[model samples]
Target: MALEGAAAPGVAARRGLGMFVVMIGVLISAVDGTIVVLALPAIQDDLAMSLSSVTWVVVSYLLVVTVLATQVGRLGDMYGRVRMYQAGFLVFVIGSLLCALAWNAAAIIAFRIVEGVGAALIAANSGAIISELYPPAERGRAYGFNAFGWSVGSVLGVLLGGVIVTYVSWRWIFWINLPIGALALVLAVRVLRDRGERVRRRLDPVGMITLGLGLFGVLWAMTGLAAQPWGGTQLAFLLGGAAMLVAFVLIERRQAEPTLDLSLFRIPAVTPSLLASLLQGLASFAVLFLVIMYLQGPRGLSPIDASLLMLPGYVVGAAVGPFAGRLADRWGPVLPATAGLAVSAVALVVFALMTTTSSLWLPAIGNVVIMIGGSLFYPANSSAVMKASPPGRLGIASGVLRTFASIGMVFSFTTAILVAADSVPRSTAFAIFVGSTTLDGPLAVAFTDGLSTAFFTMMGVMALAAVLSAFRGRAGSPQRRPDGRAGGQVPA
Candidate 1:
């Protein structure tokens, strides 16, 4: 069944509020993610953390969120999306407070895990909520606004971190989230009145456990590689993680209600859109980390300034979101998504060509182009995933989409470590990544060479993604139905 009590296009005001609240939710997560990168050096100093422990501060959160995404979205399907989503805000606020007050490395990692649970809930459900709220004809527009929130939050992460960390305490970064979360939670309560219908399905404990452990093992090994070289421990973790993932696929096929409905891949739109999301995340996030490290270590820029060089991309991307979404609503996802990937490749090529003496304008211009490409790609792709999903399984579909999206990011962490370790000592590269130190002379040249290799490699990955985007068949577009309605009932 379709979600109960969804807002129609005529109710512009309520829909606007609905969009506003969710976008704010998006902003909260994005800000927290980017702001922490700037604050990591401070946290390391304050807690006297080892390099591995400091890395865990970020890795722990990503691992938890990635693991819990599908499960939480399934819960949203069974209970209520808005109810679960609101609860995420409350949990995140508490986590943020605890993190602000943490006295040691262990405490911070524990608090971050708590926060990740909340973030998982939020990320898994945001797209579903948007699908439920807006009619298919206007979903792209709503999602575009959602992208705006991400852009604004990322921009603030850089701009605010520069000012706050330089002048105020790094602890304030966590504390600042309290008010934001509180406000978002209250607004969500007021705006999200529609409750989705409950689906009667048993939780897939085996699937969840296997999938979670598989991810945890792989992600942990990747993070560990940042501090050390390939060894027995890393090999064991990688092989074990791969085995668990294989088991998850096999087990899922036998379960009546799997943690993820593997059958969803049969939908032509779903497969390509999900792949596009995954590839895009891998390419973009790796570049983001690589670029920041380059500016910070080799060029000796502050964390904020290094981040600022990429600001144009985020800002311009946000500006492009709604427009691209509108075009997707009118045309379809294939053109926009393919074009986005192609443009990103061009951006990466620009980065590959840059030199130590190159103007900051080179990076800035490339970033803006990359953002424009992403702005074009993201909303349309997300909307396409939702469009291809059946109404009854929107939550699962959204969850699966988020899972696919995050996969690239998790892999990007591995990619970042592998690439950075090639040019400099793993520890030194990691410290530079977190804004703790700088590089000079031969070391800087080596790091920049590694950066060039990574960028060119990413360009190739994006080009491949563009090909997949082009092949994602049109199945469930707004105009696809014979009755000339805004949506068609997707078959299970």
Candidate 2:
């Protein structure tokens, strides 16, 4: 039987347990997203994978997660967030088990796709679920904690992946998920409860197809642009993807329950916050990827060392994120978000300058600054989006936000690869790190130049984001519902 009503107070004593369950799943998903990067060398040598095949290991998972996240979020709204969350855990665990048993690169990539699907389900609804559990006033705090999981997991993935691959085996990476996932599952079953009303609605099959195809096409183009000629088959996919995306927008406009709510973009507050989140994502994601390459390739650092070098930035950011959230609650989100982006822009400039020299402290300091800026903006941006969205559409809004972040990451990755490819031979491209302090050859030097260009480009984008955030602040403050609940009332 379907569980109804909020859990009784006695039952609600386990709400913390529910939160724990959600956090564990979040950590697992976040860790898996980057853990494989650290283990790639081991995996490649053990499985004798070609470069292209190894790339698939990461690409496949990302592709699956990005495509399915929004749909899964809508599903959570239609059914129950808890049910979908648990299902995600189960699917993820199964995929992990499959990944552990894989004998070849093909098998591993296939299992990763499955794992990604599970991740999509959890990632899409985790924020909304957490928001439902907490009151509007405390939502920022809750989100801060949630973001902490993501930050910690990202750092741990680098460190743990290094230790695991070095001492144990790459297989242990997947095997580790079993215990953590099981615990989360048990707690979720015992503790989590949903109070949101479920509605029956027809699935927008046309809209879904169009969005999926369009995004797939764009991502494929971006991915191909890394190694293939710009005018070749890859460009074809990019053009096709763009066209499909246009069609998707048209179809959504006509749909009764569009998979995507185009109208939300019209809201004064929603567009800016969302755009800010995307810009932040674009800068942060690209920088991390390029920095990692720079460390490993030209700097001649091992994976473990590279991971360690990046740790301070994440630690500082994670530690300060909650405080930023608290600050956002008191002041408007605009000030913090704008200030954060400005700091990030400055940090990127410093980073670009540091690449001209080989001082470890320069990059480390720049990383810390960038992270602080990111931490400050993330919670504030999220709060703004949540406050701006209609209560009835919270789940959808959360999903859209996550989707934008994912889309930004996709573009960042593609952009990083394209920049690298333009300067280096396809064979040695991945190994080229773009920084001022290190140059191995002409190709390496060119790669560094490309990296500089990308950072400058990111700085420009973040500056624009800061300006937009100020505009968002000027928009009338979010009007609360008559009952005084910020997010509980349905949209009129």
Candidate 3:
């Protein structure tokens, strides 16, 4: 039998099936992104990699995804989103199988790049597909449900990664994706229908190449800067990356159909929402990464234990997001966005004060606060971007928004690595693992202090985000909706 949302006659069942298919793809892709963190040590042991090299395992995935996200979104618009979505699932499954069979770190990282590319395609189009499936009135609810997949996936990644690593080999972490991915692909093909007309525009080869290379350079430099000396190969990469990025900007300005529509920056609502997303990413992504390390590395918590500790925070946030989206629908984006950022800033401060000797409640409380803040902002920010974008350009706008968020994540990770590298000794990286497992001695103090510093930096970043969020379009502005409806005005 065909899934619910297939082009079959049954409307209700088809819609439900379509939503499920989309959410499965979303959750799995997101879970894969973070699940590897808990498995990092296992991977290192298996491959005999240095701490710095191990980081590339994560960085490679992120960099490839971030760079290609916008391009893939555009491709979805030119082709059909359903087609792209199915292709993404197939590619991701192939990548997962490659990762599971990898013999070394280099091979795994290479395979992860393939996975990242697939992930980018899926992420860039998931929301666009949801919007196509649901009417405007119900779209908010549908998007809220989609966001839950992201939040739950993050938590599941940590929890499942722990479980898999504890009982199974690290390779199982990747192997797990195959069956789920295949299921998603089958459901998607059976449910989601092709919607858009295939446009036959020439691909902007120069624009695509420049943008990809520029992003790769920047992300590469950011990831490597901390591990390599300032005057060495890292610095050269940074400079080269920056120069290429400059060339990209210049090239894009002259292109008739640039991969990225630079003109979108001119839109009043789009600019603030994009900037807010970027800042939110910079401030928040590193916070979670460091927290996982702190809990599993220095606090002597097992992977499962640490995942459980973080459960409350993610649950609270995910629960509140739908309500926050409703509030945005009524009040406007500014109040919720500003309030969320403020809450996040406060949470970061609390998080910064946490030491090994501090009560566990402190960190838990801080995490909850940050999640609450994020849930408030995310849906609202997304709504604003959709409202501001033209209907014909929804896919492009989504791409831009996602690209900014991905870039923010890259920056956050890079910053965390740089800061942690300075605070923790390269040789004693294993000490962190030992202290985390034992949780009983002076080594715990050192590990906690390093974490505290990392949290402090994250707090500073969140505070900066708060300041920027306040500048989001004034309350109660008559924002233009993609559907040209005044009833969708953003509240001041």
Candidate 4:
């Protein structure tokens, strides 16, 4: 018998199960992301790490993911999304195990790089996987559910990280992933089959190396400048990175099979949606860290307590995601997605209004508002990009999207610290960030003002994102096949 919209009975089941596996991957990734934040203090103390070294634990993962996301996504196109996705799980699991058993700062940082590679593989392919599973009209809802996984995982991460770091060892944070990763691997094997034709393109080694080195150089400079004043070393790296990136662009123009696939920008929906995602990411990701810094630094709350205040937002975001996605399906991506960015911009205004003595409810309310905006934007935006992607280019499209977002993320991390440090000593700001110290009185007020400046800057960024989202035009319609799958060529 057929299921909804003429899908075969087992086809629906397989799609459903495949999505479940994908959600698990997202969940594991989200949990790892937030869980590590709260546990950093413990990890630093145990490993006897300096603030700079401890910070690398987080930077290492993000840098690796940012550098490799596109490369791994290309691998998905060349091989199979399912196969590559499963490989991600195995790699992530092993990385987690190594991290849990890490002997020192370097060891954990190296293992985190391994974890980042796994994360890159998973993230780069997930959108392509969803696009292959569901028709264009249904992709928004699927992405909404994916957002739900992120929300739930973030909640679990905060709760579990707090409890484990306080009562148990910090190692338990990584250990928790073992069983979950194993289960996801088994389920993915049973539920996922490769769909769509794999594109066999030669890997562009020069492109990968140039892009990777360029990103590393720029990112290294940014992060270093946060801890130290502008110096020759930082300038050299920054200029060198720019030069390499220019080289990468020229190289891509020459390559028959480019790593980045510059032609994907030909799709009308692809360019704006990606820039919106990048700007929104730039404006959004740092809010969590900034808020936590405020709470822990000036408000004198513990790591767990500070994070708990944001829990309500995550819960609300999870509930709102699927609904916003459905609206995207009906009304197209521009309306809801743009509206979401506007809402987030307003939330940033509220955050900027806060002071050291402001009511705790202020940040709490702002968190809820911002999260609602995120819930609305993320799924719709993702659906737009995937829907516009040509079949053979889906993996690259997803990778490019991920690469842009990760670049924003890594930079956002550095920006938050540097911007906040403008009003206080860099060491104090760094200490508060890692939950190693707190401030009071005059220092607290100055720090709060600094955060407000950052918030206002982000608000401007979010406004730009909203404008981009508003002008993305419309994602083209694809004809549906008899089996309820999208047919016809996607418009460029």
Candidate 5:
């Protein structure tokens, strides 16, 4: 059997509990990631940080999580999935406490790294844990529920973040994670008791370090774009990062058991879905902060009211998720997934067109359209990737999916900051985005002008995403074997 600890007498009950814990993990990670976006201004004002430096509050978490995702998944396969997953909850709680106690830029960044480590552990293993608990026949539905966790969690983050940043201290954003994480930890320890499957493999330390540094250098260069022109320092880091990435590629080819198995891309179905997800992430994630900035900045709405406008989208997404998963199961991932991307592109266009007198409904209505697209896309793409994976490497496949998604998110975070930096003073843009301050006069008009450029650029990305999604091949088409030595039909 692919899963090792699922043979107990009350297997069904354990599976149900197993599903619950995994879902909770999804909720916690999702909420934690976005909760801080609305509070960035508060963090910057309180800490006396540069506007450019403050974006790290969001980017750092994504960067660390991106770096560790695959490595942690590999560790899960070597040790125990449930054990590592449970540990994530404990560590996340500790990190959250530290963040709440933080006094300045360095302390907050350091503590957030701790939180990101914990987040990586939870995110890397969530899919594998659920995959281990559920048989192949039921995976699509399970993934749909995972999507449910994501939608609900995002909704909670925006709503709760608004309230805390407005009334309570911004520190409460991290502090709030305490009770929620603790409860999840308690349940995870009690309910998720499976030892899970294992594979005998050595950790690829060289590959991990090289890849980590390589991505870090590139991301750091991108982050610099927010502040000033690319100088010698940026160019050096960029080149060095590229060199390290090249070395990582060479090292992986020579290894018996690589950190990232290059062969996973050999699966036709897997590659396109991975790219589609990357494009989707690139095209979407940071738009949340952009819209929030618009409402909280020039529109002069409070954070709470701004976020309230987004409530409808999340509700609709929560409603759409399960049914879309069912559709992917019945038809195939290609149609629904691609269509979702196309639909979301229209929403991006709508967002690009928001004017000074636009109704509060513009973003809210645009969000609804985008979430409907997300509800269709996320589960379908996830189902496509997991279903095509060999049982043994499911963890890595899931890790790769997460890795690509994180890479896109890192870019999204940087891209938003970079684009916004063009029209507003970097500090002011960052401050206005997080609601540390408001904008008026020519500054508001110029900021909107910058947003127009950014959104138009994003529309181009969405178009690319739609094309990639379209090329994911027919749902029932045959895909290459994971090992690349044979062929198999994609399960309908």
Candidate 6:
């Protein structure tokens, strides 16, 4: 019950240190998410990349992480989570170094893929690692700190990306990760220890290959559709990817140790928690891109200036996350998680109401509203999933959670560009997104209208997320223990 010991001397201190190290991992991943976006134009100019190719600098990392998260998490379950996590740090550092030294477009994209593998390893296991260290009662608070890492990292990425891209070289962006990662890697080795039981399951090569290739095919098509008009190629990839995914499901059902532990969904709380995360991600991830497009496209703000507008929200959200997580720990996940989604949906409504002539403060206020909602949702949703997961399957649960969230993120990226392009020329819409071009006059008005449409669409998605969150049952109830009992209470 509750991971071996609570009264042991020095264990609590070690756990605290371990959690701190894990937060740093979350920080690095979050920083990378936004940092690269601001530097894309400079990278394009320096490397003489075509418009389409520059976007891959961002897409490649997301794609690789999305594809490999579950498989790597399985590795964590088979080996040691701590061992794989340390390896993630090493590989990420090396990939960043390669990125800093990259000479051409193709090289940087390839290096980003390398970086993504490390990221997948880290992202896939961080939750399970936390679960191994902390018990259910405290996981919400721990995840709150995790969200805090994300908030601070998002803010840092924007500020650092802007400052470095303007005054320094874009290469420094990748270089910046080096010192942070190195320190974290050393700390990870010294501070974190594997406390969970290991499963000696055979690797599912068929499931891995099918899932990876399937996701890649669909993602490649979606990213392509975002940059250019849809065609037969996109349709073909979509259908082929769907078919492969179906085959993956069929294969998983027959396997002894399936890559995805589909049985996890049988728990009452698990399915809703995972679905809520995916839907929340689908609805919310693109808001950053959409708002940036709004500021850069119609309002003609520079990248740095636009990012600054969103900074206060991240600041407020970071501060609020721990408190909301405390509420989750006390009240169960359903309340705060669903309430957060409702709050975020309200913010989307506000965003949808904006226009070219609307006050700039409109979006600033909405950003604060949405980030607060996000702070509430992410930690609770995560806590719910991990809390319900059995000790032995924590890695699988964590991996599936990352996989769902990554899928949402990838789709949200494509949805933002494709939906906004409806009101402008496709190339023009893509240019506005990447900060290479700005719109004015009628084009600006039309593009703003498109942004409103996209906002409304996402708002609906958030509503569905709220509904799913509400259905997660009582999160404060006892979770299943390793001894086939509910928490510490034994059956009569």
Clashes of 6: 0
- What lDDT would each prediction earn against the true structure? 0.84, 0.74, 0.74, 0.87, 0.81, 0.85
Q: List ranges where model 5 is wrong by over 4 Å.
A: 1-10, 473-492
Over 4 Å off, model 3 = 1-13, 199-202, 429-447, 474-492
Cα RMSD of all models vs. native, in order, equals: 2.5, 4.1, 4.1, 2.9, 4.2, 3.4
TM-scores for every candidate against the unseen true structure: 0.95, 0.90, 0.89, 0.95, 0.92, 0.94
lDDT of 3 at 107: 94
Q: Write the per-residue lDDT of candidate 3 for residues 261-329, one digit (tens) a residue.
A: 777777776787788888889888877777766776666677777767877887787787778766666
Candidate 4: what lDDT?
Answer: 0.87
Residue 271: error of model 6 in Å? Answer: 0.4
What is candidate 6's TM-score against the reference?
0.94
Q: Tell me how far the alpha carbon of residue 418 in candidate 1 is from the true structure, in angstroms, after superposition.
A: 1.8
Model 5 RMSD vs true structure: 4.2
- Locate the minimum summed-lDDT window of 10 residues in model 6: 483-492
| lDDT for predicted candidate 1 compared with the true structure | 0.84
TM-score of candidate 5 against the unseen true structure: 0.92
Taking all chains together, the TM-score of candidate 1 against the true structure is 0.95
Worst 10 residues of 2 by lDDT: 430-439
On residues 1-492, what C-alpha lDDT tens digit does candidate 4 reach at each position? 012352688778878888899999999999999899899999999999877678778888988887787788889988998889999999999999999999998999999999999999999998889988887778888899998898889889988988888889999999999999999999988888885687886778898889878887887787677777899999999999999999999999999978777787887888899999989989998898899889999999987788889889888988998898887766667888999999999999999998988999899899999999998999889988888887787888898899888878877887887898778987888889989999999999999999999999999999999999999856554444677554554444
Model 2 clash number: 3
Error of 2 at 61 (Å): 2.2
- Residues 103-196, candidate 5, lDDT per residue (tens digit)? 8998888889899999888988888887777655456667778888888888888888889888999998888889989999999888886555
lDDT of 5: 0.81
Q: For each predicted model, how many residue pairs clash, with residues at least 3 apart or on different chains? A: 0, 3, 8, 0, 0, 0
